[model samples]
Target: MKVSTRPLWRKATLFKGVVVTLASLAALTVQASPAAADDVYGKPVGGAILVKYNELDRETGPLGCPTSIELDNPDGVGKRQEFAGGTIYWSAASNAHPVWGTIGGKWGALGYEGGKLGYPVDDERTDPDGAGKRQQFQGGTVYWHPTLSNGAHPVWGRIGELWASYGWEGGVFGYPTSDEGWEEPYQSMTQSFSSGGLTLFWSPGKNDETSWCKQECVGYSGAAGTDWFKETRVETYVGTDQVKVRAIPTRNGFNNARTDFHGAWNQVWSMAPYPKGINQVEHRSLYEQFACHAAWAEERLPGDWNTGPTWDLESWLPSIGMEKAIDPVEARKHKCNWT
Candidate 1:
């Protein structure tokens, strides 16, 4: 085979064009109104920025200011910026996950509205979601990072185990107990996430002995300097008349190992969000439970509602309308245009 040497700038330009073209096409496909015939060709090509990030966890903490990259020849107006993507990893943060593709154009920086897209928090607005309410996570695949090479595990189990399966089972840890406090015991849980590094800990019981307790079911010690100890806690949140949630702890660490139950620390499972229809109490409870859990977790371990001091979970946030945007990149890659 013969190879021709091409200038680095020429190659970069070529690669950028292909990506921008594909992204523009994707945007056209999803646009509510028909795209202009010459929209992609009419304008002078410009540059656009594609931001990449890992799913937020209690570990990675805040990714900081919105990632901004420039691609050429973008089109559209929202918050007056180009395209915006949100946390989309849970399923494959450490594996070959989906990627999102967006067309290059000029518009205000994308931000998160109540549910709508807004600029990054660091930009201006302090509110979490911002003004928009559609609450849609846009951008087609082409953004997810492949799983890490070598041996690396996730700190938490699959989102399903935390939300769908109800509780943990198998040969996973039971409950850890100590002289200070304790963790509840139920079924063992053993799961291997696509990410192959961080260890995941869970309790696996919804309504066990206590609403929240240490791993070994122990109580606070009346000692001095170092009285507090790690424990397990299982709590549930009921929403309107259609939602309920339970969280437990199995073990906690960036790496895997035999957990002591009560001593090992880390959030295990988080129940899936359910609809309340017309009930506000349940809705409130749902929010309360998650907030309380976030708060309690802040005290026991190292975390926060927005970002964690000890852990990072922004990458794995379980927003409602996420799956729809799961793997645009993969979807487009294997999609048969004619078929």
Candidate 2:
């Protein structure tokens, strides 16, 4: 759309019954919002500018300075003005609203008006539940949940698409607990939602748009340097108090196999019991090669906390009929949404 370069943008429709509303608003005698300081090539006017200025408390509007003059979109779709703090967007159907801050930043990253989310249908504000912040875009809404380490993060795109399908905040996922984080192993980004009960993971692959898992899953396979890396994470306990002590060897790459424990040079696993129990797990050790042997593994002793080169865990694969290590391993992907 074509946006006017002028400071004042006049629309035939806004001149209609809006005059009565503007006059009534003027009767309030509230302080008109002051014009922005930075992009001040022109002085602020009185008529339509005053109405918009008054709509937002002068000097107190969410958007501070008028970075760009109010103008009609080239497509003649709506009205908009850029500001220091945010932008005030107006549509006859949706009215005028401010899109700013974290939500606005994310909207910009998604391409603003040119992005999938066409326009700001409404302002950036809290949702009905008051759990987190919300902003409406043309295609969809962007939501921000407070982060423990950082202030907050944004969740958008296909993840947002899936979130909408799950019933938004009211869905089983509930409000987001953390912003998105990139999983180097999976070549994906995931965000915690539903108070960590459910996690939404989004992959770059067009087909693997989004997937929800309880705990982070390095996954069963991926190419080297992709999402592949051997790990034995105790994902979750049987319940709340019990440490069921579950351990499973996961395929680190797409070429991972039962016989080949280490696919790429990028592989290792660790176990600690020293000061707590007394054990050590390090590669190039006896245990690292023979871990598959239940008897050999159980009989072995753990070393000091920082000890290394413990036991041999090799050839255990072929002993168990696993000869080729380049074959595909089973894919047993788990879910974070499971009860």
Best candidate, TM-score-wise?
Answer: 2
Error of 2 at 54 (Å): 3.3
For model 2, what is the error of residue 337's alpha carbon versus the real structure, in angstroms, after optimal superposition?
A: 23
lDDT of the structure predicted as candidate 2: 0.46
Clashes of 1: 83
Give per-residue lDDT, candidate 1, residue 50: 14
lDDT of 2 by residue, 190-269 (tens): 66665324555555432343422233222111112224332322111112221112222222232242334444222433
Q: lDDT winner among the candidates?
A: 2
Residue-wise C-alpha lDDT for candidate 1, range 186-274, written one tens digit per residue: 23243222221212233333445443322322111111111121222222222112222333222232222112222222233211112
lDDT of each: 0.26, 0.46
